[model samples]
Target chain A: AQSVTQPDIHITVSEGASLELRCNYSYGATPYLFWYVQSPGQGLQLLLKYFSGDTLVQGIKGFEAEFKRSQSSFNLRKPSVHWSDAAEYFCAVGAESGAGSYQLTFGKGTKLSVIP
Target chain B: EPEVTQTPSHQVTQMGQEVILRCVPISNHLYFYWYRQILGQKVEFLVSFYNNEISEKSEIFDDQFSVERPDGSNFTLKIRSTKLEDSAMYFCASSEGINSPLHFGNGTRLTVT
Candidate 1:
């Protein structure tokens, strides 16, 4: 089965520091990757997605991710983190079975804590 | 922006009681899904519905769970007999088509005592 791995369980960084959360996935073919952010009391919000095309994709809230096919990795990154960016981040891989039903397989999220 | 909406933000039910969680997907979305997350656990896919029928379901979706699209705008998930292990935050999501990003609702917190 296709699966996702987010190696970092929790990451703490200074407010102005650069941030990178690593993700690796195992899939049979070209994978569809996504990054989602969840605040303490809010629903999961789509940060960005990569179905195909450019290796780097930009998303809302100053977020971007790079899909490295050879490494089977798609890591989320930000140039300068803000206190508001302290939230749980999830990496997911979109999969489609032969039946044409599609679902997202999510990794164990990485909780980010930003210190001012 | 259009979004999926779920009702009864929080529901408390007895172990053997039944509970129904409701959702109204984005107006034009054609694919619907239900996912659940136990506290401190990864979000899991439960089932996917399309064309008024279930297209796929995970092992977690067994005989006890059922889904319905009774009307044009309503989608529902019913647990016939809730169990303690059923306590989790259930999310409803929808997408325009295959390969589209899923838009999730705020989620319904189910607590079975």
Candidate 2:
């Protein structure tokens, strides 16, 4: 079974500081990786995804994630953090069975807080 | 851009009662999914529907849960007898393909009291 672990439960960063949210997964093979953001009272929004090729993936809202195959990790990063970027971030791993069945396993999520 | 929509932003049902959550996926989407998140917990995949039938489902989707595409535009999840554990925010999502990004609705907050 595939599982995701986000080490940090909550992170606080000052405005304009760089940010990185760590994510690690345990799976036998390389799997589809994704990062999603959820604002209060809103649905999950796709930040970025890593299906294949290009280890460094860019997404909306100036977010980027790098897929490290050897480490079984995909970490999301931003050069500068804004106050509006405060929200809970989730990292998910997509697994596929031999029969074309697929499922996404999500991590506990990291709550990002930006200080002005 | 089109988006997935779910009916009844919030629903409160008594334990042992039945509840139906409705969703309308994007018109051109080929895959539909239902996921639920308990308060402060990670979202869990309940089931996926494609071609008018269930393509995949997780263990959480027990015999008590059923899904149907009754009409052209409606996809529904029926819980035969709601339990307190069934209380969660149920999200409806749709994707064009296995690799495409899924668009999620605001979700129906099911509160079983």
Candidate 3:
């Protein structure tokens, strides 16, 4: 079984400040990691994903995350955050169920607050 | 860009009543899925469907819950007896092929009282 842990439950940052949301996972093999964001009343939107290749993956809305195998962590980071970036973020680990299909196990989520 | 769509953005039903959530996946996608999130909790996967059959399902998907692709494009999840605990936001998603990123719908808020 695979699981994800997001250490921060809530974080607040001022506009123009750098931000990082921590995520840790426990998986038996190589993991497929993803970051998703959900604004109020909105569905989960894919921020970025790491399947294979470069350790750092860039995503929509100027968001990026790095996959660190040694740390068992895939943390999302932004050089600067805007007021509109306030949202709930989730970290998930995907496990292939075979035949090319997979299911994602998500963390409880970290709610981000951006102050202007 | 194409998107998966779900209907009845909000639904209010009495406990013990039946409810069916509908979704229309992207035109060319081959895999479909249903996920739900209770208030202030992690999003949980319910089931995944492909080729008109259920490819996988989580333990939360039990006898009371069922999914069907009645026609070509519509995927529906039916709850035999709604419970208060079943009240949550349900999201539908679809993907093009093996390991493709999933595109999600806006989600339907199911409120059982």
The collision pairs in model 3 are none
The C-alpha stretches of model 1 lying farther than 4 A from their native spots are A98-100
Summarize candidate 3's per-residue lDDT along B1-113 as a digit string, tens digits: 78888998999999999999999999999888999999988999999898888889999999999999999989999998899999999999888756687778989999999
Residue B20 in candidate 1 has what lDDT? 98
What tens-digit string does per-residue lDDT give for candidate 3 at A1-116?
A: 99999999999999999999999999999998999899999988899989899999999999999999999999999999999999999999988876567888999999999988
- Give the Å error, residue B16, model 1: 0.6
TM-score of 2: 0.96
The Cα RMSD in angstroms, rounded to one decimal, for candidate 1 relative to the true structure is 0.9
Q: What DockQ does candidate 3 score?
A: 0.70
CAPRI accuracy category, model 2: medium
Clash count of each predicted structure: 0, 0, 0
Question: Which runs of model 2 end up more than 4 angstroms from their true locations?
Answer: A97-101
Docking class of 1: medium
lDDT of 1: 0.94
What TM-score does the A-chain of candidate 2 achieve? 0.96
The residue-by-residue lDDT of candidate 2 on A14-111, one tens digit each, is 99999999999998887889999999999888899999999999999999999999899999999999999999999999887323446788999999
Q: To one decimal place, how large is model 2's interface RMSD in Å? A: 2.2
B41 in model 3: Cα distance from truth in Å?
1.1
